[model samples]
Target: MSKYIPGNQKHLTLNDRIYIENELAKGTTFKDIAAFLCKDPTTISKEVRTHRLSDWYHKGTFYNAKNFCIHRYHCQKTNACGKILLCGIKCASCPTCNQTCKDFEKERCKRLDKAPYVCNGCTKKINHCTIAHKYYYNGRAADRKYRELLISSRSGINMTKHQLHQKDQIISPLIEQGQSPYQILTNHPELDMSVRSMYTYIDKGLLTARNIDLKRQAKFKPRKCHKTQITDRSVFTHRTYSDFCSLDLSSFVEMDTVHSSRESNKTLLTLFFTKEKLFLAFLLNRCTKGAVRLTFDRLEKRLGTYEFISVFENILTDRGSEFGDPVSLETGIQGIQRSSIYYCDPMRSGQKGAIEQAHTMLRMVLPKGTSFEFLTQWDVNLIVNHINSTPREILSGRTPYEVALETLGEDILKAFQLKPIEPDKVNLTPKLIRFNH
Candidate 1:
C-alpha cells in the first residue's frame, strides 16, 4: 500500500483507519505503518489497543473431545493448576476440555504480543483458529465512541447544588434592590461570579430575581420607521459628519436631552464639552423646539453674545425635534450667529458618542422609569456638578472641573451656576438631592 501524507496535525480520519487496516493485512510493522501515515508508532499501537473488540469461544466443541474425563472435577475446582501433581495444564488449552467442563475458560492468543493486537492481520482463517480469543478494530465503532465522549464532556454544569444556592442567596437581594449585576460584583469583591453567569442564572430561574426585575433586560420594542428624506437638507449641506471631521477646531460641544416617564412633562437638557469632558444640565418645563431655543437665548443673555459665542462656538447634536430649528439655535435674539450647529446622521447617535457615554453615569443615579416631576434646576445642577467633579482616567486622573477651570474662565463657570464639588463628597445618586434637603 502507498504511504499517506498528512497535511496538518489533526485527528485521524476514516481514511487513515482504512489505510492502517490494509497495512496490517500486509504484515507491516507498526513503526513502518506510522512512517507511511506520518504519525508516531505509539499512536498507532494505542489506537488499535483502545478500539479493538474481544471475542471468545470454546475449542473443545468443534474438536469433538470427550466430556467424561475423570480429571474434570479436579480441573473444575481450579481452572489452572499451580503444580504438576494437581493438573498438567490449564483447562481451556487442554484437549479434554469442552463446554460441559465447569473449569472452561477462553484462552488468549500469544501472537497478540507480537505486531498487531487484532485479528485483521492474522494469516490463519478466523473460523478455524483453535485459540478461543480474538480482537478486531472497527472504524465506525471508534468514531461513534469518540463523538459520544465529546458531547458528554460538555453537556453539564460543573457547579454543585450547594454552591449554586449560596450564589443565589448572595446575589438575589442586591438584584431585588435595583442593583445591576455589574454593580453588585463591583461592590462585593468576594462574590467571585462573572456577570454573564449571573445573567444566565437569572434567565434560568436559578435565582429569586427574574429577567423582568432587571432595569435594562426588558424586551426592546422595534423603533418606529420614519421617512428617510431630510425635512431641510439645506441646513445640513455644510454641517454633515464628513464636514465636522475635516474641521480642526479645538472646542466643540455635544448636546442631548434626557426624558422621564411618559406621565411626566419635565426633561433635562444636557451639554457636554468634548475637550474637557465638562457636563452641564438644565431642567426644562417641557421638551419642545421653543424650549430649546429659549434656553439658548437665556444663556446668550446671561453670558452676553460675545461670551456665548466664545463658549459655544460649535455645537453637535442629534436630529431630535427639540433641535429641529438649528437656525434659531445658532442665532441670538439679535439674529446674529452666536454659534454654529451640526447634526449627527439620522439614527446614528454614536456619531457623537462622548455625550452618550456620559449618560451612563446619569442613569446610575436616576434609574430608568424614574419620574423627574419632583426634580428642580438646582437638583439638576447638583447632579451635573458632581458628575463634572468626578476624576476621569481618560483625562489623566483630572476632574472635568479642574480642566475647565484652567481652560474656561471663572466667569463662564459662574454664569452657568456651576461650582466645583469636593472629590470625596461628589455624589451621582438621587440620594445626593435627598441628603442635601
Candidate 2:
C-alpha cells in the first residue's frame, strides 16, 4: 500500500474508482485501499456509499430466514406477526427482519460505522449472504453520470426573460445603426454583455434584430471547384504566388479593381500598401486593361521612376482581365523595368487579403450595384482620403495617413492627391459624398 500524502486536493478519477472496485473484490480493507490511492479512509468510505447502486428483491425469492436463524425450520413460533411467519425476536442476521416485522428494530454494526461503511471488503460469499438490500459501485456508470451532470449544469442562461428583453432593447438600436457589437460595447460601457452573447441574442431572435442585420453575419456561399484551365501559361509561369513568397521584402502593394455593375464600364482601381494599410483609389473611365495601364502611367509620371520604384518595388494582384497586361505595368514608357509583378492563384483573392478587406470600407459608402458612372476622380479621392484617415486598431490606434506621411513622405501624398481628415470628422458613409455634392 502507498502512503497517504496530506493536503492533496483532487477529484477522484475513473482510474481511482476502478482501483477501488478491484481492491474491494479482492477483500482488501478500506484503510488499505485508501493508503494505496493516497486518499483519506473517510473519502473512500463516502465514495463507496454515495456512488453505489442499490436495489430490492422479493423476500421469498432470494432470501430465507431459516438459513440465517439458528432455530431453522424446527422452530414452533406461529401467529406472532400478522405480516410474515417468522420468529418474533428482532434477528440481526435475518434479511427481512426490519422490512416485514411490525415490532422489529434495526441494530447498527460498529464495523460498518468505523471504517468500511458497506460490505465492500466482506470475505463471506455474496450468494450466501442474507442481506436483502444490495449496493454496487460501477466506475463506468459513475463516470457517465458525472459527465451528464457537468453538461446539464452549463446548458442554459441564468438571466430571466425580462432581463433579456432589457438587454435586447439596449443592443438592437446600435446593431441596426451598423455599429458592430464590439464597437457598441466600446462606445457604451453601460451595456453589460459580451460580444458572443450579443450574437446569441440575434441568432435566437431574442432582440428586435436578426443575424442578417449584422454586416458580417451573412453567410458566404462556398466556392465552387472547377478544373484548372491555363489559357496563358506564360502569364503565371514566373509570376506565381510561390515566387511572391520567396522574395525577401518587407512591403508589398496589393491591387484590385472594384466594379459597380456588369453593365457599367466605370470601375475604381484600388491599391493597398500592406505594411501601412494605406489605400489609393483612382476612378477609371473604362474597365479595361488600357485604363489600368494609364492609371499606373499617370502615377509614374507624378512620382517619377525612382520614387515609383521605391514605392512599388513589388506589386501583387489577382488574375483579373484589367491586370492582364503585367508586362506593360512592370515596364516604364521608356521600356525600363520599374517593378516586379506577381499574380495570386486562380480564385484565391485572399492571398492579397489586405486589399480585399479594404474594399469592405468602400462598400460601406458605395454599396454593391450602386452606379459609379456619375462619380469623378475627385469624389473617389475624397472617399479614399477619409478611409485612409480612419484609425485602425491593427495599426496600434494610428491612422494610415499618419503612417504614410512618415514612410512615403508628404510629397508623394501630394503627388497622389492623398490627404488626411480629422480623426473625429472621418466619415465612411454615402452621406459624406451626398452632403458635399
Q: Candidate 2: worst 10 consecutive residues by lDDT?
A: 1-10
| Runs in model 2 lying further than 4 Å from the true structure | 1-230
Q: Please, what are the lDDT tens digits per residue for candidate 1 over residues 1-437? A: 22112123356767777788778777788899888777889889987888777765454333223333434434434343333465645563455455546545444566776558878778887657665556877777766776787799986567888877887887888888999999999998787888998898888887888999998888767577542334766778788877887897777999999888778978889999999999888888777777888789889989999989989999998877677667878888888899988889888889889999899888877788888999888888888888998999999999999899899988889998989888789888868877866
Give stretches of model 1 more than 4 Å off.
Answer: 1-230
Instruction: Write out the backbone clash pairs for model 2.
Output: none
Evaluate all candidate structures by whole-model CA lDDT and list the values in order. 0.78, 0.77
lDDT of 2 by residue, 1-437 (tens): 22112112467778888898888777787789888787888888888777777554224322354233333333443443455666565343455544544544333334345545556666756675545454566777766777788799987677798887887777889889999999988887777878888788788777898889999788756576442333666778789999999996789899988887656668899999999999999988666667778888889999999899999989998887667667888988678888888999988988999999999999988998888878888999999999999989999999999999999899999998988898889899989888877
Q: Which ten residues in a row have the lowest lDDT in candidate 1?
A: 1-10
